[model samples]
Target: MSKLILVLNCGSSSLKGAVLNTENSEVLLSCLGEKLGLPDAYITFKVDGQKEKVDLSAQPDHTGAVGAMLDKLKAMGLDSQVGAIGHRVVSGGELYSDSVLINDDVIAAIEKCIPLAPLHNPANLLGIRAAQNIFEGLPNVAVFDTAFHQTMPEHAYTYAVPRKLYRDLGLRRYGFHGTSYRFVSEEAARFLGKDVHNLRLVVAHLGNGASVAAIKNGQSVDTSMGITPLEGLVMGTRAGDIDASVYEFLADNLNLSVKEITNLLNKQSGLLGISELSSDCRTIEEESLNGHAGAILALEIFSYRLAKYVASMAVAAGGIDALVFTGGIGENSDIIRTKVLNYCEFLGMNVDAEANLAARFGNAGIITTADSKVVSVVIPTNEELMIAQDTARLSGL
Candidate 1:
């Protein structure tokens, strides 16, 4: 039997799992449990190029979901093949700078970060605990989404708020999507034929949750998302970079509580709120093409704000050698890419319209003119693979 590394990412209402060959990082099996803890919950698994879905009438929680997934793996005679388990943790909160072996102390630390990543860390902890229980003797590793940004300098991560809030409460910039950034930045360096330690790059990870990072000499120098994932560029449901006064205005005029306002910003804003249609960018783009005013405005705002953040990241890097677009919208949306690059023309980055459109569906290549001052490329991010590799290494596989 082949040694496999199981990579698990647990969201608020879902759990995604992937089994990868430890040696070459090829996915051997994948599954997703959606609507977890709800009556209509279901588990979808794909193996041997075949897909199957099973409904859970009783509504399994994360633990039950993991049990179901394990049963399937065991039936395939792959249970003992798992060498290590990697969990995608959303926040490390200065407690961890890199992937670490899980233990009682690690669980406590992850619990401490729940306030920093209210919606994500708790779900992550649940998955971690469940994996620990199921895969008792196997090594478990945590690959944090905020770990890569720990290299950011104090000035880059510190907010203008009172120092007590930061010192006492651990309130500071803890940028998310770091695993994706780490993978793509290294990949970008490889594509440019330059050593990662010597290249300066700007990465735009635009998806449901979006952020731009200024990577200088293989380390994150600065990033747009701060304190939380809600402070960066416009995202699917997040109202990013809003003025602080809006919270006050909403409280006074709209009579919204802090929690209510936070829910509004994180769950109901962004493309969904502005477009008043859907949070999915593809939907908005289609609507924009069909002359929907709200969708047009949403796309315009997303692109324009993204372009500005990319430019700002270049400044943070002192000069960018390359610009990388990754994540769902970044990798596939030609319309969004073109709109963003149009605004970045002043930075000597010219987009090749044909190349941009051609580089979709996991095809990664240069989308900029040969003589362009800055190289622009699209690279699909593989956070799962990155997590597996990290787990394999940490587990001594």
Candidate 2:
């Protein structure tokens, strides 16, 4: 069988795929389908650094978009070379500790996790089903974001809710961004020339959806996200770590229903809510540079909360040996990194200003002084590559 593993990330309005040669770490092809189910839906294919945009207005659903992607691969003579399919699923609940080859039972388990990740699991299920239908004999694998964090201790996962509720409903903390954390943490250990199982790491995965994980002895000891993605660090649109009673408070004060309150918190809050502008971090950073008050506050709050979470993760790890940054914002925002490190002076991280500034835009390196108590580095996350590797291993490649 060919070693080319096709990795798929299915979101509510978008689907992204990349075919990677697992043996050589080369990306043979990549494509993205966006605005699915909308009139202006389209898919973009990138080959040899050249991009081709294909209009998908007539076939504006996930199935059609996925079909287009497969057909495009066939046109490029890469369809038969793909050995296995890897899917990025947001939540596998407590059912999976690692990636699994997709089967009917696996699909049912993922379906059972719909309540845990309503915005994600349905789309992922659709992608898995679509791939299975089209690929026929190809092995499809489910690589869950929550799987890597499954090693979190019981105390860290258990909520202080009713025992019966947890027993009956599986109510517990299931942190996300596990794939990113696993990749970055291992990369950090490799950089330090130490075994990953011997290092204590606190990783900040700051993308549109953000979370922090405390990894101890190569396992997740604790994390920021709880039963849902909302109970973690402040994100692009999520109001993370809010008091549960805020729901009732809003219902009474604003005469809003539970559904309306949920939408407001999950979709209308976070950076956009605070800045009263775009949720894009680049936009906020640029406006902050221009002295826009809302943008300034948004940036400040973002870094401040992230610093606080880093401190919390350090404590959970019994004090961290190194701090790793990944994801879009963590890897690119030098301003945010500087602000976060300034707040974390107590950690004795002597951040090299020049090094931090130079570690943006896909650059990866240490950003702290050689003698600093804690090592800080930016490691760009490649969840797709991680998923592809998992697919390769589980598919007997």
lDDT of each: 0.92, 0.90
Q: Which candidate achieves the best lDDT against the true structure?
A: 1
Q: After superposition, how far is residue 122 of candidate 1 from its true place, in Å?
A: 0.9
Positional deviation of 56 in candidate 1, in angstroms? 2.9
lDDT of 2: 0.90
Regions of model 2 farther than 4 Å from truth: none
Q: Could you tell me which residue pairs clash in candidate 2?
A: none
Measured against the true structure, the TM-scores of the candidates, in listed sequence, are 0.98, 0.98
- lDDT tens readout by residue for model 1, 231-254: 989899999999888989999999
Distance from true location, Cα of 248 in model 2, Å: 1.1
Model 2 lDDT tens row, 1-397:
3668988899888999899988887888899999988999999999999999988987887877778888988998878888889999999999999999999999999999999999999999988987887777999999998999899888999999998988999999999999888888888888779899999899999988989999999999999998889888888988898899999999999999998998998888999999999899999999999999999999999889999999999888998898898999999998999999889988988889999999999999899888888889998988888999999999988
